[model samples]
Target: MGKYIVIQGQNIYDVALHIYGAVEGVTDLLVNNESVSFDTDLKAGDELIYSDDYQINKEVTAYYKMHGITPASGEQHVYPKVFSLPKTVEIYTSAKEVGVEFSVSGNGKIELDWGDNSEVQTITLSDKITVFSHLFDSTIGNKRHVSMYMQGHINQLDISGLRPIELYILKSIPIERFVLNNATLSIDSLPMLETAFGVSLDGLKTNDLTPLLELKNLMSLSLTQTIYRQPTIDAYLIGLVRQHDNRRNCKVVMTARPSGEYREPTRDSNSHYRITSGMEAVWVLTHEPAWNEGGIWEFIINETTYKYEQNH
Candidate 1:
């Protein structure tokens, strides 16, 4: 059994829908708490008991899967395991200057270990985006391996700025969202990856997407300013979600904003990607025409508002 505390303006039906994905679970809620009936008023902080074996409607799960959004009741969040470190990231680069910028949805701590025998730098993060950078010696010709260890639940990691190096991360962290630009990082690097945004897929032949076809848990992938050699948009988007004989649902975002005079994607500044998977993917490419409205779009998911604005 599980307990749900009532909040302001909540009633038995709200609890039923929240737990079971449908209001029909009201019967089960009423039966479990005989002391409380439909006639009884639900007050703030009132504890209500519910069965653990309750089944969420299949449609709810399908809808979530189509968009790569995981609910609280999903199996991935339920599994438990032991790990030496709860979260870790490894970066393989030869760039003299190495740095990474990312943010967390809540409170957390992230530490970086530069392989060149530098002091381990620590970053304390809040809802505000945090950045950490370290300069490496360009004199060294060999590639250096940098590592990141994290504590607490941080939601998003953006690897922008200078990339084009190998990225290796542990499977324990379960980071569901990522932002990549000019990066040679393998898609298979993160084990629990469910949603990702390929920041810039500009070049066609240069983007070796062989590793992309081998994904497992990916639910959404939006490649901005994309230029692929695929026969058609339909085949390319569907190929992302299909794994040979096994097929799955994945929501993809496509927009057709004209390139700049230099043929680069129009970007007045550092634009934003969907920071969290729970944030709805508004104006998704579902059927027919391949592009969506190219401008600022607003989306509200899970009571949070996120805007995907482009300066076309």
Candidate 2:
């Protein structure tokens, strides 16, 4: 059988890269083929053919053929031991220069390109900060950056291949899926990334999301409110516990509001914990305070007083 080389879905540079490892390696051979250049990219179905002589052949072949270069008939052709660096990036631009794109859901896609051998990256911008810069072209003496930012609503950031260098969230928004490969996230622009996908506060700093619990979409919340004035604090805690006990699934952690008396909820075998009176602190921690079949309920008046209450 005659030995033939075939490369499918690659441009001249890519074929050359497969043959000699770099575009520079086959510059002399491919310079005669003016249709292809070093930077000229190829699609998924391009092909290059070589005859049994290991020389370039001008013939179109099937779509699903062998990729890269192959050996010639009698010559012991050795493929490149190494290859050029593959570009590491996938980017998307915004249509509305300052508006939302993929607000909540959908199979929508933006733009993607791995210009050269660059590091992976991910970036996010809030409404206030609405500009993303990138260096897509390297040969232009100076790096180039494209502008991508919207005004209202959360933009679905789509940079898959590049490692994350920086991420910025301008305003508070329910993050659907903000992935950063390996970079520090900048959230200084007014409560950025309040919740992940508008459901829970996962992958976010606790303090940054406290104020957003009031959002209607946030379900099953665990709120911890501290109270001072020991005597009054117990009442407050009890009231909150009673309110939250029957809710679906919620919790609250509390510490003294004004640094009076600091008391944490304690469990007692006999169901009686100590409480204190006025000018002290008390804790009334409750967890979904619905009616239970049988359980011990301890009530602390302040930090000295204690009450043994049974759950009905």
Candidate 3:
């Protein structure tokens, strides 16, 4: 990333919108400069390193060292900027045939390896998602590990009807937005390591969302219209996140409901912190009425308090 010297008084969100033309860019800023939080004030002349298309200038690296600021390693991004670098998702399916596809902006390309030793499918990406469906070849084993690589800087990746038993996204660069639908995958099987910034899950398997607490890099999550046919929310995940070190802002969207009547698990439960469900958390119960007609509930969690704003 290149360097930026703030010439005006601003905050993290302002700077992110200014630099990347999108407020969501704040995730990269936080990842790069851990010393700076979402609430950090950016005054004029404050030097900061950010993700960019340009190479890191050696002098900028030296300046960071002299200033005792260590840029956190790993993908750290934006344009309102396209995401370059290749982002990959591997799907392991028991289905007789495997099908998956996505689209990317710019002149980016997509490659799909059937893993059946057949010819790889490559396409120049377009506005519409390029789809690939392949029948399992018995000689190569019907069960396959199909892989898709997205090249270039596309913000969102959406794949539906991929009933993968196991799915994982491994990337050289972070894909800020992702959507998974019609899959048997569970959050527990995901690596969850800094791969995504915002994820929307719908029509997926696993109502047990306890594994969501393990997420490390996320600004937004959507569970609405998901596996939970019951108007239930996983308050346990929220309680644990509140207990953990995530004071920074995270937006969670789910169906309208309290945590439901199940025994909630927590660190205090002495179960090694494995997530449990039960009890209507204060926040959920308070906002339960907003989504009575099937709307979106956005949960905002900050340092001390948590709340939700609903759109009907």
Best by lDDT: 3
Model 1 misplacement above 4 A: 1-87, 98-105, 162-164, 195-220, 231-236, 240-251, 255-312
Residue-wise C-alpha lDDT for candidate 3, range 50-100, written one tens digit per residue: 888532234433444455543222122211323343547777776355444
Each model's lDDT: 0.48, 0.32, 0.53
**Predicted candidate 1 versus true structure: per-residue lDDT over 215-271, tens digit per residue:** 544445555455543333334333432333332334444442211111112223565
- Residue 110 of model 3 has an lDDT of 68
lDDT of 2 by residue, 1-312 (tens): 131134444445445434443334345444444565455554445443432233232221111124323322121122222323222221233211221112222232222222322343333344332333444422211122232233334434333223232333334543444433222222233235444332321223222322232332322222223222444434434433334333222222233332334445454688644334211222443221332223323332223333223441
Q: Give me the overall lDDT of model 1.
A: 0.48
User: Which candidate wins on TM-score?
Assistant: 3
> Roughly what TM-score does model 2 have, to 2 decimal places?
0.25
Please state every model's RMSD to the true fold in angstroms.
22.5, 18.1, 20.9
lDDT of 1 at 125: 63
TM-score of each: 0.43, 0.25, 0.47
